[model samples]
Target: MPADLIFHHYANSPFSEKIRLIFGYKQLAWKSVIVPNILPKPDVLALTGGYRKTPVLQIGADVYCDTALICDVLEHLRPEPTLYPPHLKGVCRIFAQWADNTLFWAAMGYNFQPKGAAQVFAHAPPDAAKLFAEDRKSMMAQLVRLRPGDATSAYRSYLRRIANMVDEHDYLFGAQPCVADFAACHSIWFTQTQVPVMADILNATPSVGEWLQRMMSLGHGTMAQFDSAGAIAAAKAAEPQPPGANYLVDSAFQDDHGIPLGARVAVGGESFGPEPTEGTLIAATRTHYTLLREDDRTGAVHVHFPRLGYTLRKVEAG
Candidate 1:
């Protein structure tokens, strides 16, 4: 039987939209659990230890933190619509990473300018914008954020580059959409769907806009409403898949940090959203880290973080 995919995310979250679109392209059936846009994400913390990034994917007792890993897991589960197509495999991943980080931040910096911010928070409570700003500030204090004007310039150039690619092909790559397309489209999706007031930035590259429509048409796959309570229950009742249960298991532990498999460790993103998820390191594969963390509400759930953008630290014996 296929494991139930429980997705925790808010509707307006751009990162979440990327995963949702991938779900559509792959024709996945998943359970949706809406999470708060702001912090005090009690439900999220209970499952992930402390990593509170949007759009956490939970399958049974396994919680995948980042979208990159989530995409890999989904690909492993359902390989038909392969995320990393062979011809475009290496380039697709590199492009996806750039789009997810550089393009995403640049688009966001442009999207959340004063006018865009006002429009984005217009429907929310008066203090929503301020709170959201402050919250993001605290979470990303160590990282250098783009300035609105600078971001606008960068975003425009990126759009033109994207247009060049899509002008020749339907997607970022060829006819079929790859992970790069999903990664690139989310911020543009945000601009069009959530902050149309600022979407004019997309006009310079009409081809990109055309590409966006094509990507949007994929639509989120089959979905059912689920509550965080039910998700917690599912985690509690299920045991984590054995180490390397799927091909996700690496042949041998690759130890650059000198941290053993059984050691207590904290895994977190390298820059943005550095909040660590502390637990016993059950698996430290070349591509990811698996943390076995226990909670009163959720029992033991394996929290996985991709190695590319994340850091791992062993907790010294106390």
Candidate 2:
């Protein structure tokens, strides 16, 4: 059976945008489950067992967290129109990593300034902004964040660096749009599309603006909405395919926490919105890990965790 895809995400999420674009790029049918932008996502938490980031990919009993892993899963599902070209594979990986880590944070910091924040909360209640601010503050561990001034300065520098890349070719790395280009462009898209009041920063780089149009033209493909309950039902109704017989190079299991297989454990990012989920570590491949966790609201589910920026510790000895 062609794997059923459940994208657990919200519309305004930039990382979610990246996956949406990929879905369109591959012309794959996906079920959209609009997760809350903030916390207390009971449905999602139940499925994840703790890792609560946006844009998780669910296929039957397998759940894939992190856009990077989702990208790979999508690639494996549909190889044509490859995101990572054979010749540019190394550069593509490097660029995608940089885009996800650096460009994404910088653009978000710039986009969430006082004006942008006010615009975002314009339709919201008085306490809405306060609650959001408090929630984000708690996530940051009460660290004083970069002021609007610092954010603008940093964002402008990052934009200029991207423009330098475009000065050579239409795309960041080369002629074709690689993983890096799409990953980097989504954050900028969020700035320009979601928070246009502060989008003048893009005017400094005409090339990037042109590139943004190209990326947007790719357009999000055939997306049909489905509720959380429906998604869980779909998952429970299906079974995940075993990862095909492919041997991983230098594949050796690292037993760090003495958490044996089938032990109840949760894996997720360390800091900033640390929502961990409980699951069983059934498969730990070189590229990814699989968690078998069931959600009462949704039924038995399989959640996938990327081995990067995630911690795997036992869920007590119970």
Per-residue lDDT over 154-230 for candidate 1, one digit per residue giving the tens place of the 0 to 100 score: 99999999999999999988999999999999999999888999998887889998999999999999999999999
Put down candidate 2 lDDT per residue, 14-36, tens digits, no spaces. 99999888887778888888988
Q: How does each model score on lDDT?
A: 0.91, 0.76
Q: Which stretches of candidate 1 lie over 4 Å from their true place?
A: 246-251
Model 1 CA lDDT for position 160: 94
Compared to the true structure, candidate 1 yields what TM-score? 0.98
Indicate which candidate wins on lDDT.
1
Candidate 2, superposed: residue stretches over 4 Å from native = 142-145, 243-259
